[model samples]
Each structure stands twice: as structure tokens, then as C-alpha cells.
Target: MSKWMMIILIRNREFSKDMNGLVLFCISVFVFITCNCDEEETLEGANTCIIEEKYFVSKKVVELWPMRTKSHVFCWKVPPRCTKYYIKMVPFEVEKKFPEFRNVNGCCDGYKKVGDKCEPECLKRCVNGKCTGPGECKCNLGYSGTSCDEVCAVGKWGIDCKEDCECNNAACDPISGVCKCPPGRIGKNCEIKCPRGKYGEGCLNDCLCKNEARCHPESGQCICRAGYTGTICDTPCQFGHYGEQCALECHCSNGLGCDPVSGACACPPGFTGLYCEKRCEPGRYGEHCKKFCNCHNNATCNNVNGLCICPSGYIGEKCEQICPGWSYGDNCLQTCDCNGSYCNHITGKCNCPKYWIGEKCDQKVCPDGYYGPDCNQLCHCEQTNHEANKETSVAVASSFCHKHKHKQTRSVEIKILTKEERLIFQYVKDGDYKTLANKCAQGVNMNIADINDNYQTPLHLAAKKGCVFTLLTLLGCGVNINAEDSDGNTPLHIAVADNQSHICTSLLYNEANPFIYNKSMKNAYQLAMDSEDNGIKYIFQTNRLQWYQKIRKLKKDEKKLFLYVRKGYYGSVGDLCMKGVNVLVANVEDKENTAFHFAALYAQNIVPMVFTLLNCGGDINARNVEGNTPLHFAVMVGHVDATSILLQYGANPFIENNDGMTAHNLALESSDPSLRAIFNEPLLSWYLN
Candidate 1:
């Protein structure tokens, strides 16, 4: 044997030392046959042997074949009866020669040779199949395709699709074999439906239905309860309705309504109760009777508006104020003459002064022998002299009788009268015109110089007492109406100070001097200003203005000029100016407005009148107490004609008055464009300069 065969035999002997001698001899015989055989014949036999061995060995065994060159060759030829037994007892050396035997010199006809071994060329990986030869594959059961890469069928999955699917009502994933559950169904096989209150895919969504209402299983939308609506069944019923389905109408009365959610009545203003049917209580008002009234003094507030209905003598929102002044009764409609006494504000009843009685406290003498304001003073005259002096006393008492007169007569004794007592007893206290006339006619104790304890004459006493008839009688008797009392108060002053309107009128009618200042430096008119009586002040003011107008008569020329100017008689205005009326004499009336100022203020023929005054030396720049010059009055009255004439005659446009307003400043504020333009011109500055 060759060196290779010798080495092979030696290696075999060491490995097969435990084998029987017969088995060893058989193996030696196989090696000798394989090594010495014809090259073609041996190769052909090896090829045939590899083909037959490949039927038993798996493809994994083919792939695991060694690639290295083999130094020895081992072949087996089994007897027919020992085929199955000999295959199981195959020697390790023979098992190792399977790939070389199959390839037979290089590679088998259908196998490709790689390095030292042959393998089938499978384009696809042999999954679930075997490679038969070069570029060929034998697929396993339930597998398909040349390389067994394809799964079994459309509905099959897993290794070779061998395992059957149990996807009961659901479709399976072709790739993973996982079941695909439908809506409202869950579980691996989709065999179960979603449980109650559970919905959506895989039963993952929870229902939001309310009040025992059901929801759509797939959408989870709520079926609302009877009294509720909205997608989540969360909204309450609509207005004016409540309860299930909002079908019940609210039964609230008095234009009220009920809460939709809670079914509670919503009361209207001035109405309260479960159904808003009752009006608000006496002291309660406003919506739902929630507000307490603030009405005072037994007053009630309007249930709807909460405005207080005030009782008699009360006013204001809470009826807290009493009627003002001498007003009384409901709405303060009644008037009373309390005569400086406190009166009932609600009843108009005067709280009479001492020795006084009657509704207005006007009664002077009390009933019977009383003689004071409260009727408390008693007469001290003795009864023995009553008969002797009855006639004389009656005459004296009759003189004092007047309107608002005492009807009852007192039987009082009369004493012989002094000159002062004659005036005082007859006129000052309760004097009457008839008694005074009789006294004066008989020339018995009648004295105009008689004064009372206050240094007041009968006229002062009459005026102070508001005795209109006595005052006239005193004036008729030629008594001094302006005689000053101890306090420097003349009868006119006393009349005004006492708020005696009728007495003031009588004194003024009798030519009483209102302008005479007393020791206090206050004339009748000035004293009247301090009086609270509107009527007395009016009388004094009216007479005083008349006196001033009479005393401060305009000159004949000035009067004619002013009258003509005031009446738009321009020709007469020129004539009076020609008569040399002293226009520059500041002859302002009670208002301190000069003829020029009046002409500029009131004249229709403003230009001519203003010219007439200016030519007669009327001061154009002269200002009244109100700081109004003729030009200022011209601007104020929109007298463009007078303003132009005054400006042309060198009137000072820049001269400011006590109010710090120049004619130019007033012109800028006036309504006339000509006045504004004239003052705005540079010529005004030239005239001012």
C-alpha cells in the first residue's frame, strides 16, 4: 500500500481496537477497494453511493460537512438483510466520508463545489425545507416555494403554518397570527361583547350616561335623563320649566318664575310667597321681600318702588323731616300764624303765648277779667268807680276798637288821663280810631309829643303792634310817623323791623321818610333788609327806590335828553345836548348807570344817542359800580353803532374797569363782529395811546 493507505490503516487500528477482527477486516477491504479502483469507475461508484446515502442523511448533515481535504476514504456496501442494522452501526470514519463520497472527485452533478465540499445552491434560505442539489430545494409539509420561504395559506400563520388558528369571531393577523377584535368586542378571539357601561374598541371606553339612561356602546354618547339634556346629560331644564324633559311649566304667580334646576320660585319685586302671589309686608319691600323699609313716623313705603308715603307734617324718603316753617297737615298744605309761638307741625295749632288764645294766637285780651297773652293777668280796677266812669271809659275803650277787635267789653274803672296816658291807653295798647278822634275833637289830653316807656310814640306803638287801623288813625291825627324810639328806631323802622307789612305800607303811604338813618345808622329800608318777612322788605325797598328817584331828579335838559335817547328820539337828544345839559355830571339813577351807559345799553338809535351824550361832555370812559363803561355796555348789549361812535370819539379801549375787563376784552367776548373787529384793530391801540 502507498504511504497514504498505510497511515490510514494505522489510524484505523488505533480507533477500532475494541471492534471485532471481522469488522476491521471489512473496513480495510473497503479502503483498499476505494484506493485501488479505476479512477472513473471508482468515482462513478462513489457518486452512486453518495446519492444513496443522501436519502438517509438530513440536509443539516449536508450543510455541516467538513470542507477540508480527506486523507482516507471509507465506503460501505450493506447486505440486503443487514441494511437497517448496518446503517445504525456505521463506523465514524465512513460517516466522515459522506460529503466526499457525494461530491465524487469535485462536486456532484447537481451540487456546486465550495472549497473542498459540495452544496446545493438555494436562492432562498431553506426554511422548513431541505436543499436537494445545486439550486434545488425540497420543501417541508405545510411549506411552499423553491426555498420553503412561503407560508401555508392566506388564513395561516406561525412556523410553516402548521398550528391551526382559533380566532373565533375575529380576524387574525396574517403575519403574527394575533386576532383582530371588532368594535364593542374584546378578548383574544373576540368571542365576548363589551360589558355593561363599557364600550368602544376593545371595550376600553366607559359610558357617561346619567340618571339610568343608556349610551351607545360604540360611541359612548349619553342618553340623557328626563329632566336633563346635552351630550353628557349635565344641563338642566330650560327657563320657566323644570323636571323630566323640561315639559312641566312653572306655576309661579305675579309675573314671577321658577329656577330651572332646583324648581324654586323666583319672586318678582313687591311680591313674595312660594308662588310669588302675596304682596310685600308693611315694613318689607323690594324683590322677594328681601329689603327692609326705612319709612319713619308711621309712614309706609310703596311696595313696588320703596318710596315712603309720609304722614302729615313729615317729608323726605324716610319721613324724618317735619314740615318747614308754619306749614302743617298732610303734604304741608295748611298755613298757620303762630305769632312767634311754637305750633303743632301736624295740626297747625299754635302753642299760645301768655294771656293769648285763638287758633293763631291773635287774641290779645283773655276771657272775662283776664288781660295777658295766656289770659292770666287780672284787672285790679275797683268796682265802685265803674258807674261813675262808665261813659268816659266807654268812650276811651271805643276809640281802641278796630278790626280783629275784641268783641267782649270789660267793666273797668277809668282814671283821669295824663297826656302820655291819653295816647298810650287809646292808641298804643288797644287804641281805636273813634276814641282817638273823639279825644282829638274835644282837645282832651291829646298830645303828639307823648312817648311810652320805650321812647316810642303812638305811631311807633301802632306800627310795632301791626295795628293797621290805629296806625292810620295816628297818621290822621298828625302824629310823627318817623319819630325815633329809645333804640333810634323810627315808626317806619319799627314797622319794617317787626315784619309788619300793612304798617309799613301805611307809613310809606303817609309820606314816612324811609331814608332817615336812626342812631344805629340804619334807615327803614336798611332795617328792612335784616327782616325775615319778604313782604315787609318788598314794601320798604319799593318805597325807598321811589324816594331816591324823587330826590335825585334829573335836570330838565338831562331828563329830556335821556327820554329822547331812550325812546330813540335822536332829534330831541341833539336838542337837549344843545341846551347845555351837563352830561359829564355822573347823573346815574339808582342802578348807577349813566345816560351814556343807558344809551349804549338800551337805545335803538344807539349811534345818535351816544354821539349826543358824548358831544354834551358825557364821560365815555366812566364806569358804573359793575365796572361797565358806556363802551362796556355797548359791547354787552351788542350795540355796534354806539360802540363804533364811542371808539371813533377817542374812547379808551384799553382802560380796564374794577372787574379788570377793558372794553377791548369785552368786545372779544361780545356777540357783535363789528365790536370784536373794532377792538381788534390796530387803530384801537392808537386811540388808547
Candidate 2:
């Protein structure tokens, strides 16, 4: 038999070995040969072993008993018994257990290796998504499908598109289940409407409605309130129309309209009641009967302007003056039928003289010593003096009586006198004109005062008693006309206190000191100012006007000031007033119209003139001959600024002119609405103050 040797190539590696090394080596050789043999065959007995590398077809790796312990096996074509020949081992590099290696044949940039394929790789982990390219992700935000591209149908979403959406009257996102609200709605589920005064989408727009109007939330359209019309409810209803879209027509009378909001009729001047259908009642007149009538003598009052409609045989603004001359009856339109005699202004009855008697004063007088309506009663002239002389005198009738000397007897009776002041005061109080005359002729002091009666003289007594003849007798007797009583009141003061206009006139004409201040610190004119008697006020007003006129004559600057005021020259008037011109001066040619009156009548707006005159002591209420004041003239000429200025300075609007028209009355009659509006303003008291 031939012997052969075999060589095996093995990698150098670190492994465990047992004490029975040959056993492991024999087991390793047996498994290696068994794995390397591709075919089974039986070779016969005597064969020669040869080292033929041609039979070493290829190298194959064979693992040993321990892991990573590898060896190279070569298949040889030797004899079947060649397995028992040489076991030569060749050393090679050892294989490492874990090693770092460059990925030369691995997946590119953003890809990873998995098993045997190059799969896509993403830097961020895909959630509900898939990696479609290198570092690329395809997300399924609210969707689920094979490709993660299909949206969840209707109300389903989630991992497998199984969750339902929750939304009300709005759109909902399938992935998140969040709702989207529409216009005029808000809330998480879009279930609430917008609040008041807010409109449009998301309730973000503000409504433009005015005057407490309403608006639609979605469309933002305004709904107007009652008494208002127009877009945004800004305009008021037109005149004669009122209430709820201005659909109702006004039913007011007297050519007036109703309130735009309430539909209530607004009454005009001199009218009142619900629909302004009634006239003002008696004793009330002017502008819904707001003003009281100032008429006297039972006269009819004008409802519109508070003017007095005078009755028969009466004249003047308040119907306070009786008709003059021979006229009588209504409006003094009828002439008296009495022939050449004093006719009664009220009744046309003739007042016959001493000897004549008839309806027309055509009949002769009654016989002497007998006096009656028809000359039938007996006359006793001596008996009238009996009661007057009994207590005051001791009559010596036998001594003064003689048939041839009757005139001397009469003179002796007239010469009877008394020094008693009480008796003389009694005569004046009783209107005993003849007794007072006799006392004056007898040299009894007419100025004597009774001690119990404020030390007042007979002149004061006559004035207090309103005895015109007694006052005249005292004046003729040359009694002290300006004599003051114990209270320092003159006869004129007493007359004014008693509201005796005629007595005041007589005392004033007789040179009584009307300007004298009494113990009450009031003069006659000042006292007259407190009286409601127009006659007494007129007397004092006239007297003061005349007195001021006399003072104006003494001053040279007055005429120039008057001329300046009349010509509406405020600059010249101011200069003149500064130079001590008398502002109280009246124009006699113009029936006592003052400088203030002319300025008010002529100027367009003389506010400076008003201040100048008022500052210089001009009378704002001073009346001219026609009873018109500065306010009257100012209103008559339509001077608004002048009127406002005068009102601010306390000008009285209720003072009437000759026609019984007040400033308010004139305003009611005015055509200019702005001028009329001045009186109707709610700030009228503010303007006055």
C-alpha cells in the first residue's frame, strides 16, 4: 500500500480546548470530511495515495467544535484510505468577534438595510405616516388608509378611521374633531348666537343703529324705533306725522303738529285741550292760558295776546280810561244828544248847571228857597249851618242881623273861626269845604296839626281822606304843601300810600316834595312803585319824566346823546354817556321816548347801547305816551340781541303797550321762527338771569 499526507488551511482564532485534544481534532476532521464529500463511493483495496492538487477543486469553510474556529477544507481524489495520512494545518488571519466596518455595500444616504433589501429611512420617526423617499414622510393627519393619503370618510377618523366627529351646525375636522363656526355664531360647538349690538361673522362687527334702535346679527340691518326713520335710525319723522315708522298722521288743531315721539298735540298760543281745540278760559289768556288777563272794567280779553277788548264808553290798554268829550256807548262811537251841557261819558246823561234842569239841560232852575227834582220841596239853607256852628261858635245873630245890612251879616257869619286843630282836621276829613274856607278866612292857621294825628296838618288830612275840594281849599289857603307829618311823610306820600291818584296829582301840582324820603325811607314815587294801581304809578311816572326833562334842559350833553342814540350811533352814545350825558333824558317831541327806546327801535343789535343806557341809570321800563317801553320797541323791531340783553338786565316782558300787547304777545305774532324760539327756549330763565 502507498502512504499519502493531507494538509488543511485554518484561520488563527482563540477558542477553548479540552485535555482530550486528539478526540476533538478527530471529531473535527470527521465532520469536515463528511461535509466536504459531495458523493458516496466504494474504492477497492490496494491504491496508491498521491498529492494531486488537480483533485482539490475549491476551498470550503468548515467550523470546528467551538464557534468562529474555522478551517479550510480541500476535496482530494486520493484512494479511499487516504483519509489516514498527514494532517498538516496552515495558519491564516484570525476572525474578530465584533468589528467596525465601512458600509461600502450598504443602503445610501437616507436608507437602511433590512434583511436582503434596501428600505427607505427617515431622520424623524413617521407617526401615522409612511416614508415614501429618501428622508421623506407622507403624513395622514386626519386620515387612515394603506398609503395614508385617503381622508377619513364623513365623521370617522383615528388609527383605523373608527372615531366619530362631534359638531353642531358647523364643519368639523375629521382628525382633531374641532368645529368651524359660521357667521353670527360662536362657541366650541357653534351653538350660541351673537349678543346685542354685535353682528356679522364671529360676532366681531358692531351695529350702527342709533337712538335705541335694533339690528339683525347676521345681515347687520338696522331696525328704527318709533318717531324715527332712515337707515341706521338717525332721522326724525317729518312734521304732521309721528309714532312707529311715522305711519300715523297727526290730528292736532290750530295749525299745529304733534310730538314726533309721543304723538301728543302741541297747543298753539291761546289754545288748549287734548287736540288744541279749545280757547283760553276767562281771566286766562295767551299760549295755552299761561298768562293772566290784565283787563279791567269787565272787559273781554284777547285770548291770543292777552289784550283787553274795551267795552262801551271805555278806552286805554286795560280798559281803564273812560271816553272823553261828547262821545258815549260802545267804542265811544255814539255822540251825546245833550245840547251844550256836560255829558256823562258812560250814559250820555246831561249834568245841568246851577239853574237849568232837564235830560238835555234845557229846562230852567227851581224857584229860590225851594230845591228838588221838580221844584216842589222846601229849602232850608240856614239849617245846614246849624249843626256845624253849634259846638264851634257862639252866634250873635241879633248883633249881626239887619234888614238893610244882610250882606254884612253874611260876612260876619263867614268870619266865624276856631283855633282848634282837631276841629279844623275834622272839617277837612269830612270834606266840609265851606267850613275849611271859613276857617282859612278867619286867620286860623291851616298848617296847624292835631296832636293825636301824627302832627299832620289839614293838608295831610285832606290828602289821606281823598277830599279834592278840601285839598284845594287848603292849597288856596296857602297851607304848607310840602309839610311833613310826625313820620316825615309829606302830603304827597300820604296820597300815594292811600292810593289816591287825584290827591297825589293835586299835591304834586301844588309843589309838594314828592322826592322827600319819609321815616320808611321811601319817597312818593317809590311808594307808588309798590302800588298795583296804574293811575298812581302813571302819575308818578309822568311827574318823574317831566322832572327829568327839566334836568335835561339844564344839561348841554343830553341833546347830543339823544341824537346819537336815535341815529343808532353806539360809539357816540357811549362817549356821551362817559362824558356825563343824562341817559334819563326823554325826547318830548317823541312823546317822552327815552334814548334807550330810540336805540332799541333803530339799531340792528345794540347790546352795547343797552349796557350803556342801563349803566347810566336809564329806565328800562319807562313808558312813552303810547305806553311802549324799550323792550316793546326792541321786540317790535325784531332786534334779538337787544331783546336778550334787555332780558338779562331784568327787563319785564309782561309790561303792556298802548295796544295791550306784551313782548311775549309780539313774539307770538312774529313771523320769524328764530325770534319766536327765543321766548320759547327752556333757557329763558338763564337768559334773564
Candidate 3:
């Protein structure tokens, strides 16, 4: 302030004087500005008043103005190395007058002057930042440095680089705070979860589960659905089982299997149930039990096949029609042609008339002077011709007439031969073949028999007497070769009892039966065996050997047949017969037992085997050495069913064994009421003629 005031006063005085005074003042100021201001103070003539310039300028500049005044034209150019400067002026006269500014008159390096003060310049620039003091800088957003030259560190950003980042372990932009998420994760800052159907880092992995299944979020593993298994839920439940985890079982019946997944049974025809466990009920049948039975007459239907079970006298698939042909009853299984007579519609059995008897009503009532079911009862009808001894002949005739009159009706006629007319039978009985032939030539009935009290015929007498010639003559005359006496002794039986080998041979040649038993229950063979004559015994033995050979030959053809029969092969019995194995082989005995005994003893189901054997001509009444018929064996063994079969097949229950026991008696001994009832059933054929 004092320097400017003194300069203003001097300028006013100089301008008042003229232009010459102003010029002199300006020249003095220029000299002052040109001098170095930073030199140590040197007094140039204290009274002379010398002035030195003092100012602040860059070190890069060589010269500068000492002071700055508005009216003072002090011209100075900036140097190439220095950008700016500042100046200060001091008057020597003024300083002498006011000694306060004596030491403040110099310039300094790296400083710039602004009027009277000095300022320092920064050494380096501040990038992305601002300067705070000399050579110091603060960084802006995303940068940090003394000069704002460095960037923000990881997980740090923003102005001053002071803001902290939360990127969830992901990389983020320091300035913007954006995050880069890992796999299976998503959203800003990587915080939100991945959406469904996606998994694994960034939710990139796709689920592979099948049947609308789900997968693990972290592992991406498929979760299988119910009723399915395997990693992908592709496998179905196994057979006979179903439902989740395949733990449920099917309940199908009749071999029906179930659907694996649904557990529903695949039922066959005529079956129904969850597992087909139930059959169609009553009138219903077939698949799902939906079909209705078409049967009539209250017939039932097959549960599985829907087939009708026809009742008696009915046939056809629905049992709606009558049986065809000779078939009559129950699914057309019964035949009316079983016997010669018309069969019962319900039972398929021949119904014989009162007088006609036999299974088929084939036997006439009281034929051949006999009256019984088997025509075994002798009639009292007298023979019109006779050759009995005179003593007994009249008595025999009288006895016959009296018996006939009592037993017969008056409409029945009787003819009797005179005593003189019955000489042929006497001649034959006495072995007079010539006289017997002459009587035969004389129109006498040679076949006529004189009945003794024993009912013996002429053939019986001739055989008993061992008359070979008369026996041949009687046979030629058509005499009964096997006529039985009252004791049921046939001509063969008489010959065997009398030990007549030739007559027995003749009788055998004429087809006399050796197996027929008399009232004594003895056959000709048995009688022959009891004889004392060696020749007769030899003859019987030879005949037995021949029969045995024939049976053995037949048995050889069917050796394996019994094995089949024993195993319940009923068809094999028929096969053996068809193959020419004699059906009579069933009657051949081993150890005195026929095949019927073995069948009754060992067969599993005796009915089929017994029936087959019977059909093959097995003797149901045949006796073993123990005198046990098939019925007796059946009863002793307590086989009720076999006993029934024997009874149905006409086994003789009335015949007593050597032990004096009939089949009924044996059945009673077994204490089996059922067996006893079978033996006691009404035997109509056994009773009626």
C-alpha cells in the first residue's frame, strides 16, 4: 500500500510537469523489474536510494517482472520451461521512509506468485481423482491411489473404493456390483434358487426321470414313480405282482395271471375274480362270468367252460332236446340197446315182463319144463315116453301127475307114454345099442327120459353105466348129453363119479360142460379127481393140461396187460383183447386166483379195473382155492365200492364158500353196513321167471 501510494504521488507530479517527467519514471521502474530479486540485500549508497525487485516465479524461467502495476508498461515474455509467475515491487525511497518492508523482497523456486504470496505446483497428475494439497490426490469410483492411478481391489468398488461387495462367492464388477453365479444357482448377487426342472450350477442340467418323475436338485438324480423302478423309472412290476414297489400280489384263479401295473387279473373263459379265484356261479359262466348258461330242465352248467350238464333223458349242448338213437339218459350217456328189451327212459335198464325174465327178457317163462329166473326150477310136467323099470315107472308117473295137478291149471294138457312104450331108455341104460337102435327105428322117442325119484334121464343112466355104444346111440338120437339128475349131476358128472373114461371122453367130445356144478357143488373135473380109477384120473388130468395150455398161450399174448391193468389202465385191457389176447384169459387163475381177485385186491380204483375185467369175461363168481369169489374178496378186504361193482355185475351172493359163508355173511362179518346193503339190494332177476 505505501509503495503504490508513493508511486501514485510521483506519477501525478511527473504528469503535471509534462511527458518528459513520465518517461523518466517509467525507465526507472523497468530497471528495477529487470534486476534479480532473490540476491542478498546490498546497500548501494544509503543516501543514493537504490531499489531491488522481489517476486515469485518458476525455477524454469530466467527473468521476470519485480512488480505489477496497472499503469506501468513493464513488458516480459514467459520462458519455454516456466508456465506462470508472480511479482512484487518495492520503492527505495518509500522503504527508507517506512522500514517495515526491508527484508520482504525476494523470489523462491517451484513457487508462483499471486500478488504478494507464493504457491507450490503438484509434481504428478491425479487420474480419476482430485488434488487435495501439494502433490496429494484422492481416487474416484473403482480406483485408489495417491494420484488416483490404481483400480479397486476384488470385492471392493465405488468412489473412494470404500463400498463392500456381496457376490455369493462369484465374481462381480467392482464398480457396478454385478455377480457371476456358479452352476445350479442364479439371480442377482447369485442369491435366488434355480427353477424346477433345472439343476446343477446355474440350473443347466436337465432331469432324466421317466413317467413324470422328479430329480434331485443338487445331484440331478431321477426319483422313480410308484409302480415303477430302475434309475429312470422305466421298468414295470413283475408278473403276479403289482402296485407301488411291486409288493401287492394278484389273486387270479384257474391259472389266470395279473397285469403287472394295475394288479388286475387276466381271467380265462368261464372264470372271474380279482385273481380269478371264483368260478362262474350257477347259471353263469365264461369270461368275466358274463355268459349265461343255456341249459334246460334244471340242468347245471360247467363252471369254467359254460357247458351244460344234461339231466337224464336229455341231450345237446344246452340239454334242451331228448337223447337221440338208442341213447336215452343223462348227457346221452345211457343206451337202451344194452339188452334185447326196451329200457327204462331214466335208468337205461331192460324192464322184463312178469313172466319173461333175464337181463334182457330173453328167457321165456318155464321153458323146457323149468320155471325160475334162470330157468333152473324143474317143472312137474311129465314126459310122454319112458323106459324106467316097471316097479318105479308107475310110481314115477303117478307122482308126476299128482305134482302137475296140484301145480298146474286145467287148460294145460299132459300126455303120458304107456308102460310098454318106454323101452328105448331101458335098452340104452343096459348098454343094448342094437335094441336101442331097433327101438329108435320103431318110431320110439329115443331121447325120452324116464324120471326116477332122482329125476335121472336115459343119457344119465347110460353114462353112469359106462355104456359107450349106447351113449353114442343116444347122442345120435339127439339126446341131451348134459342132462342133470335131481342132484344136479350131469351125464359128465355121472361118468366121472363112476370112473368111466370112455363115456367121459364121449361126453366131452359132444360138448359136455366140465365146469357145471351140481347140487353137491362139485364139477366133473372135481369128481374125476376124487375117483379111484387111474385111467379116469389120467383123462381128467390130460383135459386140464390142454385147458391150462390154452390159457397159458392166451396169457402169453397179454403178459404186460395185467401190469397196465394193475396201474388202472382200463383201456389197455380192451387193447389186449383187440390184439387177439383171449378175453377169457381174465378167468385164468394163478395160485388159484383169477385176475378179478388181483384187481379187487390191488387196483387203486377197483371200479374201472373190475368193470374192464368183467367186460372181458372175467368170472365174478369164480372161486379161488380158498373158495373166495371176487365178491368174497371184496367183502373180506372191506372194499365197499368193489363189492358194489361185483353185485351190479351179477356176482352170486347166495353161493356159500367152503367156509359156509356167502358174500352177505362175509359182509356182515366185516361189520360194514354199506356192503351189507349192497348184497341185500333187491335181486329181481335172481327171484322172478
Q: Output the lDDT of residue 44, model 2.
A: 27
- Cα lDDT of model 2 by residue, 69-123, tens digit: 3344445655323223223343222222222222124345566656555677776
lDDT (10s digit) by residue, model 1, range 570-667: 54554454345555443535445677777777745554455446545567776554556788877777877678777777677766666788788888
User: Which window of ten consecutive residues has the lowest lDDT sum in model 2?
Assistant: 403-412
Q: Which one wins on TM-score?
A: 3
Q: Write model 3 residue lDDT over 291-384, tens digit each, in one string.
A: 6877898898765445577789887757788766445666666556432345566676666554455565544444445444344555554644
TM-score of each: 0.24, 0.29, 0.38
> 482, model 1: CA deviation in Å?
40
Off by over 4 Å in 3: 1-421, 438-445, 545-554, 558-561, 586-589, 603-605, 608-610, 681-689
Instruction: Name the lDDT of candidate 1.
Output: 0.60
CA lDDT of every candidate = 0.60, 0.65, 0.61
